[model samples]
Target: MPLFRAEHGGAKARPRRRRTRNMEWVGSCGKTDENGHVLSLTRLCLLSLANNMKDMWAKDYADNYLDHYSFRYIMGPFTLLPGELVEELTWLLCTRKQMSRAALHLMLVPQLRGLSLESCPSLVTATLCAHIAARCRGLRSLDLSGGQQLPSKVLCETLCCLPALRSLSLAGTPCDRGVIKAIAQRCPLLRHLDISRCHLLSPAALLPLGAPLPPLPLISLLALDIGFGEQEGDPAAAAAYLLLSLPGLERVAMEGLGQACCLIQQRQFNRSDGFTDREGVPRLVELWRDWRHRQGTDTCRTMREAAAREEEEEERTLSDGFGSDSEEEARRDGGPNCSQNQTEDRKRGGDLSDDGCLVLQLKDVKGISCDFLDSLSLACPNISSISVHVDDFENTRGESQGSLLATGLQAWSAQLRSLSMYHPGPLVNLLPALQVACSSLVSLTLEGVKIGPHTPLLEVIKACPGLRDLLISAEPPTTPWEAEDEEDQRAEQNLPRLANLCSLTLNFSYEHSQMKPVMSCMSLEKVLKCLLAGSPLLEKLSLVSLPCPLNGILQEVLDLLHLHQYFFADSTNSPLMPLGRVQRVNLLRTDVTMMTVRSLMQRSKRLKYVDVSYCWRISQVEWMHCERSTEVQVVWL
Candidate 1:
């Protein structure tokens, strides 16, 4: 039996020292000293020592004690009492110019005005601008953010350098735009300014910056997030448009943008009768009956037709994708290009900019709407990689719409090659995303979600022929909600055929046994006929549990592993029967290890590493009997 331990990095305990003091008249610690001999202050340093030091202090005083005391030795910023003592100690650490290591730390303790130090834990001086504002009076373009406190004097000092100040950021500092405008009026060259999360200001603060000056400078700003907390009083929907209207402004992030996207949907989509824009689709479908009773023939037929059309659409897309009239309505909305991206668009209400770099996330977004591309417009033209979260919460009543919303995010920046999503329903959007430069699109991650049977998971893998890394959660439908649709099953079955796939993980799965197996799987020709399709291009496979063992009925288990290494390693059109290294295999308490598990391990010559815990009830010795017999390591824990 092997021991499993939670790895921890810590300093070893130090030995305790006796706490002693002497007045030279001492009989006991509580006894008074005779002759009234007073204790020497210098001696107190040696006598007033720590007890039980072994518990907290480690042995090597400098190596362990001082090392562990990083930030721990000095009480934090709050503990420093305001006095000359602080300035004296700070000077002691700071004046040691020879000790370059201590200079930055010495400066960090001060809450002085006009100072800044971003993420760096240590800095010799505050940011260039803040330092000058504190020490030099003639300078513009100040940046004093993230570090020591910002007093009004320092803020006022920096603001004095206006018109020449083209770039200024007072982020996380305590200064308002009123003070900012007082400076802006004097400085006309202001180009870039970021005052995000400044609680004391409002949009009206921009008035001074907006006032025109000669040279008619077109100062473009990257972003502006200045405002009060969550209720930063809603900007006119035209605010962003108006800000961009400024000649030089290209990008702006005013609030928690992701949350703002949701809020925008809530506000514009909210109807007075306790209904939302998306909820209207189903309401419209229901209205068919009302219209029929009211004898509104044309309207009733259209509504009836939408209900009929919706029935044929996939459930996963219902919540997020087009309803029966989705296509027709979009067409009327001037979207004649639905055909250009029908496979990718899951939900409506998204528009791609002419440059395809920007996307306009539109109103009434219920799920991951095509509207997601709306935010793509916010990114710089050069960005090619991104991480996105489409769903923050589950909407069980609108699963179809949720999926459509998630899948509709296919509209992407031309440069996109890697994408990650967390908590979105129907991860199938990966299919449409793959269409944008298939072979070049390399890395992808899907967290806290599942791809439905209707989603072309297999088709996506096949299309991304050169894919190197992939992470996905496969939770196959557990119950048969409707009659089994063969085309849906075919799409799912094709997933495990990605011969070029390198890394893979099925975080978890709820897929039923009824789904057909992969198309390339040969041995299970008869058995897999019932359970055929799944992911195949996996160098790293992590499955919490497998309902079926790789060797038992999932016949492609060994063969797929064999094919993957051979195909990728040889880089040949012809199949190489003998494969190479299985770098890593981690299986946690899976059911597929009963029969062929031993044989599979014994045969995989390329199998260099493995972790099989609570699997097959097989012993380490039994596993060692397999092909990787030359060397073996096992940890039961």
Candidate 2:
């Protein structure tokens, strides 16, 4: 039954046997099937050819291939290749920079539905756009995000041509009002649009689309990110208008709208009747009122339409001999029932509880008062993530308004999942509020919060038991008189077990010499051990700018790793296990040594990335040895 018999006779037989062994070895190298092997070979050959050929030669070769393939496919009965395959091939060429303008024109097939020339900045030209417009008519999604060189006119014209585009990202592009207008006018079916960082395009440009008019163009849009773009106009008003207009919008990112908060604060103070006193404030107030009225009107209209449809359906059911006498009587006597329905509809319309927007990003927007936040939450009650920067907690009367801010936070705390606050001022007044309000938080990031003797960081962490990610950048104490009595008292207490914590970043900045004495009182080493022991799921541990003895902590981690390995080697399970899941260790500017680093690498098999940049203790020879010895990525700069 054997197809071939092995023979060990002479040199010729030896050579044949070697060839057979080599063939077997090659076949055992990979587990891919025949088609996968063919595809891999094709890709490798194409990449090799592209790498060897010059730009012009590559373009010529691409043109020739497209010509031959299109001619044969159009003339013969052979089915064309799948669109995804063609798109992948194009993406490969683009990523390698082998896709020239001429090649791009030749490769714009009619079957292509999604194209991302994000990496090919040189090919994002007017002529190329014209080619795409002419050939790729069925393209649904396009990402020209980093095409800052593309002119607004050309972009507008291109977008106008592609009316069928559903998703488009022009982030970091020099898009202007005309281009946005073109999108509203032409691309009516757009569901996702990201124009973030388009500095030339102001928020005023979006007003027309969100205008209180019949047949809103971008009504079907689900996500819109215009963050860090415009700062000249009333961004808050524009944001509110968009939220009110777009009923289906789920995410809105409007970072760096600090000017809007400033304008709102100014308007709040200048509420006099004189025209000179209240120039722009009344307009914004009226706009708010109009938005509220419009929301109520829309809700009432929807309810009325539903009631009318129900009445019609009931009449039809009676005609079809499927309705009872009571239903027929209720339909005929519609005065009291109609009155009750109208009252219920009115009550529902009056309630400002919008559940449309789920994510709202307002990073670095200062002067956000409690009233503004309360009103915003009233309009968007289902917001889950928000980023804000509280510059000063004082009101216009020079009084601390911490309670007011807390009120605003409480309004939306029920649904808040992620909260990032950058408070340059002291958080003594706000920490208590956050402890109570943010118990439901899953991710908490606090930057620029001064950590003093009274600031209980542990208590805040304990409040949010479900936190999966926590980042705390603590500033040094402002006064040297503030002792570490509070921290010392809590040194013996154990941190609450964070069962879900996965990432933690603790940055304690000590710029002055006086703060060094204060830092000694805070038992950071004990705190670190407690946190590590609690967070068994911790994968990323970043200790930046900490003036503590990090080497001891590293040794503890190494010992834990040894214990974990010992238990595994013995094939037994222990009740207390090590942090065996840690994958990323960032000890930037820490005092950890090479011994700890080497032992860590040898013990933790799952360790992937280690950053020891600016670590003075790590010398050149040791850094090089560690980098060469381990497969783990080691960074030493």
Clashes per model (N, Cα, C within 3 A) = 40, 0
Scored by CA lDDT, what does every candidate get? 0.42, 0.62
What is the Cα-based lDDT of residue 278 in candidate 2? Answer: 23
Model 1, position 270, has a per-residue lDDT of: 28
Model 1 vs. true fold: TM? 0.37
- Give one digit per residue, the lDDT tens place, for model 1 in 361-413: 22111112233434433433333444555554535555443343334344433
**Model 2 lDDT per residue over 2-39, tens place:** 01222345234222221111212223234333123423
User: In candidate 1, which residue ranges exceed 4 Å CA deviation?
Assistant: 1-255, 258-372, 378-383, 392-414, 423-440, 451-456, 480-496, 509-538, 553-579, 592-608, 619-635
- Using TM-score, give the best candidate's number: 2
Please report, as a residue range, the 10-residue window in candidate 1 with the lowest summed lDDT.
358-367
